[model samples]
Target: MKLAASRYPLRVATACALFGAIAVAQASVTQVSQITASHTVQQLAAAIDAQIAAPRFASSRWGIDVISLDTGRTLYAHDAGKLLQTASTAKLYTAALVLDTLGTDYRIPTQLLVTQPIVQGRLEGSLILRGMGDPTLDTPGTNTDWADQLAAQLAASGVHEVQGDLIADDSYFSGPSAGSGWEARDLQSWFAPPASALSVQENTVNLMVEPSRVPGERARLKLDPADAFPRVINTLTTSAGNTRSDINLYRAPGDMTLYAFGHIAAQSQAQTYKLAMADPAQFAGTLLQEALARHGIRLKGALRVLHWPQQADIGLDRAVVLAQVLSPPVMDVLTRGLKRSQNLYLQNLLQIAGVKARASAGQVADPASGFLTTEAWGIRALDELLGRIGIPPEDSQIEDGAGLSRQDLATPAAMTHLLVYLARQPYGAQLRDTLPTAGVDGTLQWRMRNTAASNNVHAKTGSMNDVRCVAGYVTTASGERLAFAIMLNNVVREGDEPSPSRTLDAIMEQLAAFQGRG
Candidate 1:
C-alpha cells in the first residue's frame, strides 16, 4: 500500500508484495497471465471468476485470496489489495495479537480484596471485588454466574460478613465505559455491551419471555439476575391464538432503563433474550450481593460499582487477597469469541491488551471521544502489530476489535498475511482451532453443507449490512492445505441468482475439489 499508483497497478503491486515472499508469482495465465500454473489452477480461477462476475454483485466490491499452504503460491486472487469493510473478520488480527503477546494458556483472573483485617467478622472498612477483564469468569454451559463463583470463594476464605461497602472495582481498565467507534444504535443492542475490566455474564442480561396462561394477558417476564437492569417497562402480551412471536428490546445509551414490547403467541414456549447491560460492574456487584446472601455471607453495607475517577482513590496497595476466580485458558475463551462472533469478548480482549501496552509505554489514555479512551490506545497497539506483521499501514485502518465499527477496513492480502504468519508460529494450529468450521460447527455450521468443502473447511465467517467475508483454511482434494479470504462490500442480495454467501460457498467448493499439480 505504501507503493503509489504510478509504481503499482491498482491492486496488483500490493498483493504481489505479500505473495512474492513465497518465491513464486501466482499461477499466471501467461507467466503474467500467459503461462498458467496448471490446468487445475486455471479451472479454479475460472470458477471464482464466474462467482465474482455474477450480475448480482455487479455494484459490489470484492477482495479475495486463495494461497496454498503446501506451497506459498497464490492460487487465485481478485482485488486482493483493496481495503474493504471486514465485518467480524477483524477479530483475526486481535486473535493474532493475543497469541503473540499472551500465549494460549494464559488466564485472566478476577480477585476479591479486603484492605483491612476481618477480626471476628468485623473491622472491615470496605471489600473490593476487582475485575481483571476476564470475560469468561463464569464457565460456559453452567447455570452459574461470576459473582456466585467468587462469592463462594470468599465464603471458603472464612469471612462471613462485610462490615462496610461492597465495591465492584472496575478501575483495572483505564477508559470510558464504552468502546470507541461504536454507533448509538449499536450501543442499544446486546452485542455492544461495555467492555469493562470487571465484567460478568459477558456484560449482558438474559430476559425470559413466557406466554401467559390465558390470551390477552400480559406475558411473564423473568429477568435472570432480577436486578441486572435497574428498571424495565414491559408491555408484552400474549396473542389470542397460535400466531407469530414478536418481542423487541430497546435502551438508551448510558441508561439502564429497558423497554420491552411486542407480543408472543399464546401457545408458544418461553423465549429468552440476552440484552446489553448499562453498567457491567454494577451488575456484577448486584449479583455478588445476592450470591453472598445465598452463601450465608451477610453484607452489612450497600453494593457499589467503582469506575475510574469515581472510586479512583480506593486504597488497595495493602489489600489482602481473600479469594479469586480465573477464567478458562485464553485459548478456550478465544474459541468462543471467534466461533460465536461474541462482540464483547473481542472488544474486551482488545481493550485489556491495550491496557497492558499502554502501561508498558507509560501512557494512560487518549481523548478521542473527549474523555479517556482505552480503545484508541488499543487501536494504536493493533496498528503496530499490523506494521510488525509487515502489513502495509495503508492496507488497514481498524478502529475496534469486534469489527462493529463502521470505520473498520482490511484487505484480503493483509488478512492472508496475518493468517499465514500465525500459521507458521508454534501455536498456529491452536489458533486455527478457534475458527468456525465450514458446515460443521460455529458460524459456518449451516453453510457449505454436504459439499466437498463441508466438514473440510475451518474458517471464520463475518457479516454486516452490505458486507460479507469468510477467511481461514481449507483442505484440497489433493491433500493440500490452502488459506483463503473472500470479502465483499456494498452487497445487495436480490434476484434469482445465488447470493454472495452461496457464491462464496461455490468458490470454496471448487477450491476444495481442485487437484493442483503445482
Candidate 2:
C-alpha cells in the first residue's frame, strides 16, 4: 500500500490557496514523527472509540473502520463487518467493477447503421437507429450534442426524405423498463427516469414557462426541444400578485398523463422545469419527428420499436454506416456517479455491466447466465474485482450495485477496502478528484466546514432515513494517508427531524485528525 507522496505537496498548495496562508503553515509544520505501526494502530483505535463514546453520537448505531495504507493492516474496527443498507455508497462497488471489467477507456458506443442508400433524393428504405445505451445521449451540455450531430449524419448519408418509418432498436439490454426498488412516487421525478434499451435525453422532458402579461390570465407554458412527449396539460393554477412560486409535476403510470402543481410569481419572463416521463417510447418518437423536421425529413409511415429490423420493404433509403458515437470512458462516469451520487448515472453503469456479463455468458440454457438479473451480475462482478485486489468474498454483500435497494448491504471493512483498491489504480487521480471535496462540491459541499477534514478529506456519502455513511480517503496534516468508513444506522435523534447527519460528519472530521501517533 504505497501512497502517492507527490500529492502531499499539491494538496497542501491547494489548501493554502483555499484556506489562507495561516492554515497551510499550520498543516505543513505538523511533521511526521517516528512511531511503530503497532503502537500507532492502538492509539488510533482508542481515539476512535473515545470519539464514538462522546455524547453527541451516544444513541447512534454506527460502524467505523480504519486501515493503514502503509501496511495493509486494520488499525481499528467497530462492527466493521455488519451488513447494513448502504444507500448511495453502493456506487463504490459499481464503479470498481466498471473500472476493472470495462477498463478506464471503455466508451459506450451508439451505432448508426445504414439500411439503404439515397436514390433520387428519396430514401427508398427504412432508417434504423441501433442504440448502444449511451446515457449521456441527449444531455444538454455542450459536449453532449451527439443526438443532433447524429441527425446531421443521417442527412449527410444522402437521404433527403425517408419513404419508410423511423425505427428505434433498443434491444441491446434485456430487462424491465425500470429497476424494481425504484420508489413509485420518485418514478415521476427527473432522477428516476425509466431505464431502457435505448435512452434519449436522459428519458426526460424540459418544461418552460413565462408569466402572462394580461391581467387575470394564467402563465404560458411550453416544452423545449418539443415534440418528444405527448400533449401535457398544465392544470396548475397561478395566484395573482404573488412574487414567488412553487411548482410540482406528476405523470400517471402507464399513460403519459401529466399533472403540474405549484406556483410562480407574476410577470416573470422565463423559467425551466423538469418533467419525468411515463412512456419513453412515445417521447422518443415525438423527438425524432421534430429532429427529422429540422433536417427536411419526415416519416411517411409510423414509429415502431422491435427486437429486430423490420422485415417488410418500406422503401426507405439504404442506411449507411455513419460515424459511431462513443461516451466518455468508464472512469469519467464513475467519478461523477460516486462523487456526486447521481442515481441515474450509477444505474446506467450497472446495466452496462449486466449487459456485458450477459454477452459473455453467450447462448447458454441457464437463465442466470452469470448476469441474467442485475443482482447476479453485480455480485459476480464485485467478487471478481475484489479478488484482483485480494479482498475475500466473505467480507461483503453487494446485491444491487446502485445502493438504492434496501437489500443492498456492506460493512465498514468492505467499504474501506474499496477505497484502498481505488487508490492503487492507474487512474486513481481521476477517481479521487471525482469525489466531492470536503465543504467545496457535490454532497460534501456543506459538510466538514471549518474542520481539519474541510478540504482534506474526499469521500462518498450515503443517506437513507436513519442510515448515513461516508467512506473514502483522508490525508492527515503530516501527509499520512488513511482510508476510513463511518456508517450510522437506526440513530435516535432528540426530535423527529432528519437524522444527525451533520453530527456524524463532525465526528468523521475528528477521526481524520487522529494521526495515530503516540
Candidate 3:
C-alpha cells in the first residue's frame, strides 16, 4: 500500500517553506548549551565525558550533541559544531533527502525498451534492458529468484528469441564508477563496489572454497555467478585436520585478478567470501544472458553494455516498452539498506537525486541534460536541500552519500539539527523507524545490550577505519524525546580485544538514563 501525502516534490517544497525560517543560519559550527542546568544534566555530561576521555583514546577526537526535542533545549555538548568524519552516519542525510523528494510510496522501476516488435518467435532489432538504479534487482522474493522473474517477464512479452544484440543500458546514472574520494586499494573489497546504474547482487560475487582431502593438496574454489567473477589465482593449500584455517585474498589496484593464498584445514567446512566486481553493467548483462539461455530464449548476437556517452539507436519513432518491474517502496529499500549499513543503496539514491537535478536554475529538473557527472549533481542537490533547512554548507563537506571517503565531514551539530528538523516533518516518524534500534536489530543488534539504551535508542551507526559515529532519536528514562549525534575520529583499536563502540555505547547509556527537569 502506498503512503499518505505521497506527492513527493510538492511535499518537500511545502516543508522547505514551512521550516526554512526555523533553521539556524550560522555559517560556522558552534554548539549551544544551557549556561546553567540541573544536577541530572551535569551528571549525564560528566558520565559521557568519562567514557570519551579514557587514556587509550587520548589521541582521538569527539563531537557530541544532545538536545531535548520536548523542550528544544540543549542538555549536553562537546565540540558539537566541529567538523568530523561521519562514516556511514552520512546515510541518514541521503535517506532524508530522498524520502522528502521521492516520498515513501515512490518505487524505482526498470524497463525493457525495444525498437522492433517480436515477429513470430524472433526480435528483429536490439533488446535494451533499461535500468533506473533499482538496487534490489538481484534479491529474491519469497519463492522466485528475481533473475528468473525478469526472464519470465521477457518470455511473457513474446520474446522467444533475439535476433540482435542484447544491450544493457545504464544511462540512468552517469558518473565515475568509483565514488568521489574512494581509494584504489578499496576497489576490490565487497563494500567498495562501483556505483553503476545497473547493479546485480550488489555488484559482488561469493567465492566458495573447499579443502582437499590430502594435507598438501591445493584447495578447490568456485565463484557463484560464474559468468561475472574475476580470475582467481589459487595458491591455497590444505592443512592437517584440527589445524586452523588461514586465508588471505588479495586484489591489486585497477586490476580484477584475485590472489588467493594461505591454507585451510582438511577438517574445515567450506568457506565463502564475497568480493566486489569491476563493472556492474557488464555483470548485469552477463547474468541476464545466462537467465535467458536457461529459459530457452535464443540469442543470435553478442551481449553488450551501453553507459552514458554511448547513445543507443532506439528508433524513437517506434520505441516500445516491452516489460517493466517496479521495486518495493523506496522507504522500504532505505530501511533494509540502513539496517545493514549497505553503502551502495544510499549512494544510488543520491545518484538518482542528482539525475533529477537541473543543469541550470532556469531549466526544469531533468535527468538527461546535465553536463556534470551524476556525483556532482547529487552533491549539489544535497547542498541545496541543506540550505533549504538552514544547514550552512560550511558545516559539512559531502563527497559521497555513503561516506566511504575520508573527505566526508559533518558537524555533530549539523547532524543533530537535521534530525530535529526531520522530526518536525510529516515523514519524520517514518525516517526514525528506518534507523537501527539499539541492541535489537540492524547494525546495532549487538550494541547497548543490557543497558538503559537497549532497544530504546533508535540511531544510525557509522563504521570505518579510524572512524565511528552515530546519530538519531532516543527517549530518555523520563520519556523525554531527544536528538543526538556523536562522532569519534582517529580511534586506534588496541589488538581488537576491545572495540571503541563500547565507549559510544556507554555514552548512549548515559543519555538513555538521564532524567532532567521534565
Candidate 4:
C-alpha cells in the first residue's frame, strides 16, 4: 500500500488536516461559552455576598440559602445553618403544618345547642354557643351573616324565648390567653389580642376619631361594633388651619379604657384606631346576645362562660343541636394567615390542630393524663411535621404558632427545606397559591416594583423592630424554579439610607435575573 504517493494523495491529507483544525476551534469556542456562563452565575453570587457584607449589615446576623428546584442543587449558601429570629415568616411552617394535617377542606364549626327541647315557644334549659376556635367568626366589612342565619334557624324551629342563660362553651382551647413569651406592652394593641376559642372580629374593636366642628372643642369618637368593652376618654381639641395633627391614643395593659388625647387639626381626615379586647369570650357573648335580640329571640338570663373542666363530669349527650355555622375552609384560613400575616388566624389554626391531635390520640377526655396545653401541643405537632419533612428537631425553636414571640427561631436551611418539601406534595400548588407575589399582592404588593423580581417571585416577608426576613419560591429567567430564604437579625438602620429591605430586594432581583448553564 506504500508503493505509490501521488499529488492527489498529498491534497487529500491537507484537506483532512484543515477539517481537524476547524473541529478543534469549534470545541474551544463551546468551552469558552460555558466558562462565561459559569462566571456570570458566580458573579451574581459575589454581588449578593458583597451587599450582605456591606457596612450596614456589619453588626447584624444573616442567614441565606438558595436551591434550584429543577435539579436540587445548591445555588448559594451563607451561614445557612445559623438560627435567626424569623418574625412573621414563621407563619409558613404553621400554614404548611395545618394544611398537611387538617387538609385544605377542613372547616371549623360553631354550633348552637339547647339543653332542653322547645315547648310552646319556650326553651326550658340553657342555650349554648359552642365554638371550635373559628377565627373568622365575625370579620368586619364581610357579610357572612352567621348570626342572622342562626337567628333565622331559631325562628324556624319555633324558639321564641330562651328561659335560661346564653352560655358560651369555649373549652376547645385551654391555656394562657396570649402566647407564651409575648411582650406585655403589645397586649393592648390590635396585633396581639387575646386568643380565645370563641373569637369575634379578630378580637379587636375599631375606634374612629374625627376633629370637632370648631377649634378648642373635644374630638368626637365612635367605635365599630359599638359594643366593644373599651370606653373612650376623648380629650382632643380641634385646632384651626392645616396644622400637623398630633393625635395620641393609649390603652394600658389589661385595661378596658382607651384614652385619646392631644390636638387634631380641623382639616385633617378622620383616623381609625384598632384596640385589642381583654376578654374575647365576653366580647363574642355580647355580640351573640345583640344578634339574638335583633332576631326577636328573648333570653331570660345573662351571658355566662362554661369551661371544659367544669363540665368534665356532666355529659353533653342530652344536648340538642339547633343550628350550626361552618367556617371558611382551612385553605382560606391559611391564605389569610400567610398573605396578611394575621396572628389571630394562625393562632386559632394551631389551637384547632392541637384539639384534633389530642382527640385523635384519645387523650383529651382523661383528666389524670398529663395532657399538654394548646400551645405545647401545637409545638409538638409542628415538630412532628418537621420530622416528617426530614428537618431535624434542633433546626427550629418554636414557642408559639405566630412569630410575634421573641422565642421563635429557625435556620435558613430549614426554611428552604420546608419550601422544597412543600413544592413536591399533593397540596403544594394550593399552598404556593397562598403566598404573596412580588409587587403584585398581599404583603409583597409594595415591594420589588418595576424590577426583574416583580410579579415573578412568590414569598413570605417577615419584619420586626430589628429583624427582617423573606422566604419562598422564585422563577428564574432560565425557567428554573428555586426555593430561597434570607433572614437578617439585629439590623440597625443607618442615617438617610434605605432599610435592610433594599438589600434583600437587591439579592432577590439578582436571583430573578440568574440564567443557569443550559
Candidate 5:
C-alpha cells in the first residue's frame, strides 16, 4: 500500500527537503505515505520490507532485525541470521565484553620503575617504562602530559642522572603486530597501526606539508611530537595555478623511512597526514628520552626495549617506582571507542580482556611462547560471553577486537540479540548512553536529521568499501523502545544513484514513526 502524503506531512516534507530532487527519483514517496499512523507487527514488517526492496538495494545483500524492548517479541526480521561483514559495528561486542569482564572503573597503568636506588643523586641501575596496555598513554589531543610528568617526578625524587639504559617494557600484549586480516595497505594508516602494549598518540605521528613559497621548490615538512625516527624524504615540488594536489606519503613495513612525493599547489593550504609508527615502543622510548633530556636528567646508557617476563626473572624486588600514570577509567575509554569508533582503543580493550580472562582461569601467560595468546583468550572470552547471553557461538565470526579486519562477521539477528540482552543488564543504560544519538552527536550527527529518527535513535554506524551498517536502539513515537540492526553488503556506489544509506535512513524513519499494536 502506498503511504498517504497527508498522513506523514512532516516526514514527507523533511525527506523531500533533505534528499532534494533525488528523493522523488529514488524513493516512492506515494508508496511510503500510504503507511498508516497505527501498525501491527506484520504491518511494520511489511513497511520495512517494502523500503528495503527498493530498486537501489536490489543488487545488495540486506538484512534487518527489529524487536520490541518491552515485550521481547520480534517485530520484524529479514534475513537477520545471515552473517555479513560488520565493519566498525563489531566494536559493540568488544565494548560490551570488556565492560562485562573488566569493571567500568578499571584503569590501565603506565609506570616508571627504577632498578637501583638513587644514592645522593648518583647511582641508578636502569629506568624501566612499563606499560599495562594503556592505549590512552600520551594521546595527542588529551590533556595528559605523561612524559613531562614523569620527568617532574624524577626531578622531585632527586634523580639528576641515570647510570643505566631507559628500557621500554611492552610485554602485556603478545600477537601479530597488526590485527588479524588487516589489509597490507592499511598498515601504515592511522586506523590500522600496530597494536603495542605501550602505544602513544595511537601509535601514529602527524606530518604536515606546506607548499614552498617559491614555485618549483620542495615543499616544507613538519612533524608533530618532533622526533628523529621515521626520517622523511621530501621530494615534493610546488606548482602554480589551481593544480590538483597529488601529494603521496608512503612508509615501508618494519621501517621508519617515510617517502613523500608528488606536487602541491603553491596557493593550496598545508595538508596533514597521520602515519602509523612501525615500532611504537621505540617511538615512545625516543620521546621519553627527549623529555628527560629537557628536564636536565642525564642517561649514560642507550635506550632499550624489555619484556615483562625478562623483568620478572631479574627479581628486582627492591626497585623503586618513580612515577605512574593511570588511564581514564574503562567507561571513559569505552565511550571514546564507541562514539568515535576508535580502533586502537577497542583493540587494546580486547587484549586487556584476554589478559584478565587468562588471569581468572589460573593460566599464567607466558610472554615468550604465548604469542597471540592474549588475543586468543580475548576472542574466546567474547564467544563464551555471547553463549551465556543466548547467542550461538558460531553466530559471530570473530577476528580482531576492532572491526578493522575484513574477516569479522556477525548476523543482524546476533547483534540485535546482543543489544536486547544488554538492555536488561545493569550496565545496559550506560552502554546505550555511549552510542551516537541520531542527528545529535558522533558519527550519527548528520544522519537522520530533521526526521522522526533524529535524536530518537542511539546507534552505532559502520562503513567500509561496499558495506554499511547500523545497529542499536530506537525510541518509537508511542514511547516504545526497539532494538534494531541493519546490514547492507556488496553495495555499489555509482554516480548520483542514491546511496544505500538513504534506504536505511528511510526505513529507520518509518520505524521511528511506528506506533505498534495500539
Candidate 6:
C-alpha cells in the first residue's frame, strides 16, 4: 500500500501545524514523577524506575520518556534528551526515513540484460548480471537462483552453450565489501552478508546435516546448491546425545575450507542443522558456472571479477535488454528488515539512499554521488522530520542508521518526538502496524509474554552488550494512546551477562498500566 503522505517535507510541514506547540512542552521534564499527576502516568513511570533500580538493570545507565499523544504532554522522563548508544534500534530511524523519503510503495529494482544475441542455437556474446541492491535476490526458495533461473530463462529462449563468459556488473558500490565496525567474528556468521552490487542468497549457503554411522565419525553434511564454491574440511565428531549436538561453523583465511565441529544423535535418531559461509560471491560464481553448464552453456574462459567496460570486452554481437525484476515495496521490506533486525537489509537500504543523494553541480555523477561514508544522509533526513515536530538537533548525535555503533545517540524526548510525529502522519497506522505487538512478534515476541502489553502495545526493542532500549506506541485500556522510549546503557556486569531483558519488560508493563488521576 502507498503511504498517505507524499513527501517527508510536506508531512513535517503538516505535522508542525498540528502539534508544534505540544512538542515544545514535551521537550522538558527530566523527572518522571514531576509530570502530570495522572495516576496512570505516575504509576507507569514509578514502576519502570523500580525495574531500572532492580538488581538486573539497576547498574545500567539509561534515558527514558513517555509522552501523551493526545495532549502532547510529557508524562515521564529520565535524562530524556541525553545521547546514548542505540544498537539495532537505529533501524527505526532508517525505516522512518525510507517511509518518508521513498514512500512505502517504492520497489527496488534488479535488471537483467543480454549482452549477446543467440545466433542459431548458440549464444554469441556474454550475459550481464546487473544489480540495484535487492536484498531478496538469492533467498531460499524464492526462485532467486540467479544462475539456475537465468539459465532456465535462457533455455526457454532457445539458446544453448554461450560462446563467451558470464559477466557480473557490480560497480554500483565502491568501498569496503562490508560495513565499518562489523566484527571479524561475525563475518562467518550468516548475519554478516557481504554488501555487494550483485549479491545473491543473502550471500551465504545453508549446510543441512544429520548424524553419520560411526559413533565418533563425522556426520553427513549436505550443501543446498552442492555446486557452490565453499569447500569444506570436516573435523566434526558426532556422539549419542541431544546435549552434544551443539554445532559451530568456521573458515580459515585464504582457504575455502569450512570446518564444522559438534556432537549429534546419541540415540542414533535424526536431527536437522545448518552451516553458513563468509564468502557469497565466490559461491555464486561457482554455482552459476555449474548451472549454466547444465543448460549446455559452455564458457571457454575462466571467470574473474573485472570492471564492466562501456563497450563489450569481447568482439561479440550487440547488447540488448531482456527482462527486469523488482523487489517488493519499501514498506514490505521494512516489515521484515525491522522485525527480524536484519542488519544487511537495513545497511543496504542506507546505501541506496546515498545513491539517491544529489551530487555537486557540474561535478558530474561519480561513485560517491549518491553514497556516503557516514550517517549524514539519514541524520539530515531524520532532523527534518523531528524538527517538524519541534525537536532540536542538539538533542542527539546519529552515527549510524541501524544504531549498531556505540557512538550513535538519541534522547528519550527525541524518540517520543518521532513516535508522535508518526502517530500524526496520514500513514501513522502503517507505522504502528509494523512494530512488534508486545509478546506477539519481532524482537518483542518473547517479551511481555503474558502482560497487558502483550497484545496491546506495538513497539520496537533494542539491545546491545550492555544496553537495552524500547520505543513505540501503546494503546491503554481506556483507549488513550501514548508514545515512549526506554534506553539503558553502561550496565554493570561481572562477565558475559550484562542484564536480563525481563527487567526492561517489568518496567514497560508498569508504564502500560498507568491510569490518570481523577
* Superior by lDDT: candidate 1 or candidate 5: 5
lDDT of 1 at 379: 75
The global C-alpha lDDT for each of the candidates, from Candidate 1 onward, is 0.77, 0.66, 0.78, 0.79, 0.79, 0.64
The better candidate by lDDT, 2 or 6, is 2
Off by over 4 Å in 2: 1-47, 54-59, 116-122, 140-142, 206-228, 239-248, 261-273, 280-285, 306-320, 363-379, 386-395, 492-499
In model 1, where is the ten-residue run with the lowest total lDDT? 28-37
Of 1 and 2, the candidate ahead on lDDT is 1
- Model 6 agreement with the true structure over 268-364: per-residue lDDT tens digits: 5553322234444555556667777887767775654433223335422455655455677887777777776776777777656645542321256
Model 1 regions lying over 4 Å from their true place? 1-39, 141-149, 210-217, 237-248, 262-272, 309-311, 363-372, 495-497
Positional deviation of residue 17's Cα in model 3 after best superposition, in angstroms:
48
- Alpha-carbon error at 377 in model 6, in Å? 6.0
- Candidate 6, after superposition: displacement of residue 479 in Å? 1.7
Return the candidate ranking by TM-score, descending.
Answer: 5, 4, 3, 1, 2, 6
Best by TM-score: 5
Model 3 error, position 500 (Å) = 1.5
Q: 194 in model 6: Cα distance from truth in Å?
A: 2.2
Model 3 TM: 0.86
Q: Tell me which residue pairs clash in candidate 3.
A: none
CA RMSD, predictions in order: 10.4, 9.7, 11.3, 18.7, 8.5, 11.5
Which lDDT value does model 1 have at 114? Answer: 86
CA shift of 149, model 2, Å: 1.4
TM-scores of all candidate predictions against the true structure: 0.85, 0.78, 0.86, 0.86, 0.87, 0.76
